[model samples]
Target: MKAAGFGYHRPETMAELLTLLADLPDARIIAGGQSLMPMMNFRVAMPQHLVDIEKIDGLDSINLRDGTLQIGAMVRQADALASPVIKKNCPVLADAIAYIGHQQTRNRGTVGGSLCHLDPASEIPLVCALLDAQLYIASRRGTRMMNFRDFADAPLTTSLAEDEILTRIDLPICDPDTRHGFGEYARRSGDFAVVAVATHLRFAGETITEARMAFAGLGAIQARADRLEMFATSQKLSPALIDKLAQEAAQMPAESDLHHDADYKRHLAACLLREVLERILRHG
Candidate 1:
């Protein structure tokens, strides 16, 4: 398939990009071009105008400041996976990205683009939601920030307005005492996860203090069961507690496709939760 012909505009400045976006209400912004290009090639998306922002100034910085990992919209996944700041502050994110496509794909994939694509099986949004990261969106009018929970509305959909562009993603620096781990079941190393789980655990001596869990490939969007996480914090990771967690996860609503049944997805969720929890307990 070939993409429909479209007008292309490259904006070297953020103001120019925003202005172009505001002017061309139906234009699609291309940053990394990894996600959008493929869809365009398939003719799934055929915007009349393309506002390329790869040359925009001040949009690809990866830095840690004031207890947050500030990643610009254009920061490539490969670079992010290699950042010392990310490795130390949010290793779980780095781990999750390892499962996204291959090095070539990650080399061209942008954090903002991936999150905005909002694929139910994508790793970036799941990590953002699990870690309670903040998203920064901008437009010619003004800028505003929101947490990932509000940023992601549904699969392949977000709260971003037509004229707005995601500018940056702020990931909270992990607590020194918090242990992070991520696990997923995929057909291949670089394939979308069949079912994935990201978890952060805090322990008071040998007892668990706090726990955070988020899932992918289980619902309309990546989700967290606050009740389940809070319940995990209710007791140590004993065999009984692990069984309880799995049972709770088995009840989470999950959609089914032609390849997998709803019951199968739910079973995978329990399996992933059990695997990740045991890993954290053994290593942390």
Candidate 2:
């Protein structure tokens, strides 16, 4: 199938982009086109106007400022994977990005695109959920910041208004002593995850001071293991605790898809989470 004919507008500045967006209510913003183009080609998406924001400046940087990792919305996946700042400040994110599509896709895939696409199995949104990311949104009226949990509305949907652009992603940097781990299972390399788990632990000597656990591919959006995360705090890492957490993860609600059943997805989630948690303990 071919995409329906549409108007194309490439804005050189954010001001111009905002104006175009405000004027075209039915317009869709195109960044990397990794997701939108496919949908357009399939006729799954038929926007009357396509606004391209690639020419806009200051939307492709990766910086660490005021203890926050600020990644511009246009930062490409491959660039982010190779970024020293990402690797140093958020290693789990770097690890997860390696599992996104293949080299060719990652080469053009943008961070903001993935977040907006909000695939159930997308690694970027999963990491953002685990890290409690902040999203900066802008429009002609004003700008606002949203929590990742609130920004994500439903599958393939976000809370972004028609005229708002996601400007950047803000991730609070974890403590240097925080240990992080990520693991995922896919039928093949570069495929979307069947089940993926990410976690970070800030330890005071032997006891956990803080723990964040999040999983993807089990629901409409990535879910944080709140109960398990709460249980992990002030607890010592041990085989028993790991086993218990894995069991709890296996009981989390899962949705069946064409490729896998709910039970199988739960099983995979448990196994992946256990592996990630155990790896963190081993390396810590």
Candidate 3:
């Protein structure tokens, strides 16, 4: 299938881009176009106008400041995956990005594109959720920031207004002692995950001081394993405790799709969570 006819406008300045957005009806922002192009080709999206921001400056850099990692929304996945700032400050994010489609896709995919696409099983949003990242949005009105959890509304949807553009993503740095782990199950090397787990833990001697656990491919949006985190915090992990956490993961909300059933996904989640937890214990 081919995309329906549409007008394309490339704007070199944000002010110009915003004006186009305000003036054009049924306009869509095009960055990376890794996800949107396919949707348009399949006729799932037929926007009357496409505002390309690729020529705009200052939306592709990676920086670290004041204990936060700031990434421009237009930062290419490949650039991000190889960025020293990202690798040094947030290595777990790099680990997750390694699971994204492939070298070719990563070369063209943008951080903002992945976040806006918000695929249920995409690795990018899952990491953002686990890190409690902040999303900065801009428009002619002004700029506003929101938590990543709030930015995500549902599968393939976000809280972004039609006229608003995502500008940057801010992620807080974890404590020096934190140990991170990530695991996922996909049908093939480059396919989307069926179940993915991400976790980080800080231990004081032998007991956990801080812990975070989140899952993707379990429901409409990525979800944090709150019950498990609560249960594990301030407690030393034992065989019994690990077993209990796995059981709790099995009970998380899961939705069935054509390829996998709810029960199967739940089982995968339990296994993957246990594997990641065990890896952290053994290595850290």
- In order, candidate lDDTs are 0.88, 0.93, 0.91
Q: Pick the candidate with the highest lDDT.
A: 2
List candidate 3 stretches off by more than 4 Å: none
Better of 1 and 3 by TM-score: 3
Query: What's the best-to-worst order under TM-score?
Result: 2, 3, 1
My TM-score estimates for the predictions, one after another, are 0.97, 0.98, 0.97
Return the lDDT, model 1, position 250. Answer: 96
Error of 3 at 232 (Å): 0.9
Worst lDDT window (10 residues) for model 3? 172-181
TM-score of 3: 0.97
In model 1, state the lDDT of residue 228. Answer: 85
Sort by lDDT, best first: what order?
2, 3, 1
Please, what are the lDDT tens digits per residue for candidate 3 over residues 50-104?
9999999999989888999999999999999998888888888989999999999
- Candidate with top TM-score is 2
How far is 269's C-alpha from truth in model 2 (Å)? 0.7
Write one digit per residue (lDDT tens) for candidate 1, span 1-284.
78899999999888888889889858998878888998999999999999888888888998889988999989899998998888888899899988888999999998888998999988998899898889999999899999998888888999989999999999988877788878888888888888898988887776779888999998888887787898888477777888999999999888997687889988999999999888877776
